[model samples]
Target: MFLRKSFTAALALPALASPALAELPHDWQLGMQPAATPVMVQIEDFHRLLLYIIIGICLFVLALLIWVMVRYNHRANPVPSRTHHNTLLEVAWTLIPVIILVLIAIPSFRLLYFEAAIPKPDVTVEAIGKQWFWTYAFPKDGNFQFDSYMLQDAAAAKAHEPRLLGVDNPLYVPVNKVVEVDTTGADVIHSWSVPAFGVKMDAVPGRINHTWFKATRLGTYYGQCSQLCGANHAYMPIEVKVVTQAEYDAWLAKAKKKYAANETPDALRVAAQ
Candidate 1:
């Protein structure tokens, strides 16, 4: 009976993990986060291709070094060959690297095109980077906006949120639908990055940069300012929640009512004055 129960629990472990809506960096995580978007899939493919090419090059160099040491060392050859150079060997080395470079450039161009071409997005969110927090606005969805601040340790503990990553309000978008994020910095320069979406763009003052993603999974994704912005740079965490269309619609309605009244944060207002 005890053996049967252990087997049943083992089978249920995966089931329990599937419903977890959060996807944060885990201890001893290897490689990138599991791709949650089509762009990320392409990014991972490109990464793997590069990794294979790098490994092949390293192995070939190692083998050549070993052959030279074994066949032409002082004890093995006593004297080195007097041949100045071999045209064929030189051409082979140069041409091989060129061919390898061209091969890499092909997929690289495709991936860049994929990232640059924004689809007809169902939702658009504009993120403005402040000193240490993020403010998001849904211009197409009633123009409602809100500030998202990182929760303190006690606050995070009470809310069951991850340290330094939890926010008061997380941007929401529908799964399997394109969402464009327009970012700008209100003060100095900042960056909005999300690894799961394979989207990272600088937010420069007086200029807006945009990136898009279509989340294939329903979960929470987090990122921080990849660029060095200010003193509290590390505290600026971006949180996004991908949900079903119905849930997104519901959140939109509630957000419009809640945030439409006072969209501008008090800090921004003070800075303006």
Candidate 2:
């Protein structure tokens, strides 16, 4: 209950920032979050196409229902025709659905392949999910890892961080560059997900899963652990800030100093490779 209330307040955090700068979710939002990555753009396109097809199918079905009610009513046709089935109609229904499925499948496969084929990544970040928080490591940057915890309402308001979505240390990456994310869980299974980036990968124990994204826009985006892990699942949120190369370099320098190297030198080297 407390988490739910906090989440509700978190929706208003974007309002505090400039409308043009914030990419966080809005209250009463009816659509998916804005697309900041190439994968998200393709996802939006596929979603739109599906919506159109669904609406057309509903309208066609409605029309058929209306026509049957009008033409076959007791008063309209007193003597019913003894017809069992129309082979042409049956074939048309089957053939049309098959054609529609093919249309949907072609793009679906292409999009999957596009997402799976990660472009030569400019940077890589490893995300490790703990019981109720997230820890991130910039493997190629400086081998420094830091824990990210949800900010309290008071601290978040003071720091200009979104209420529940904000973290003490946000994961940073250069805008317009491909970022490969490695996910793993320390205790239980969890998922690192960001809607705007169209990237979600399960963080399973003893295994590292990979997902990649290239943020085209420079802004702060928030997402939560998608997979239900435990009682504090809702509290584990992800914050990503994409900035220019210069800004990224500055942050990298500061982060390396502030956050001590958590992984061993050999482990870091292996991860960087």
* lDDT by residue for model 2 (184-230), tens: 88899999999999999999977788899999999898999999999
Model 1 local distance difference test score = 0.87
lDDT of 2 at 222: 91
RMSD (Cα, Å) for all candidates, in order, is 4.0, 7.4
Each model's C-alpha lDDT?
Answer: 0.87, 0.88
lDDT of 1 at 267: 49
Task: Give per-residue CA lDDT, model 1, range 1-273, as digits (tens).
Answer: 999999999988875654356777888999998899999999999999999999999999999999998999999998777999999999999999999999999999999999999999888888898898988977667867899999888997778778898888988889999998888898988999988889899988777787899999998898888889879899889889999999999999999898878565454334323
lDDT of 2: 0.88
Q: Can you give the TM-score per candidate against the true fold?
A: 0.90, 0.90
Candidate 2 regions with alpha-carbon error over 4 angstroms: 1-19, 264-273
Considering summed lDDT, which 10 consecutive residues are worst modelled in model 2? 263-272
Best-matching candidate per TM-score: 1
Task: Candidate 1: give its CA RMSD in angstroms.
Answer: 4.0
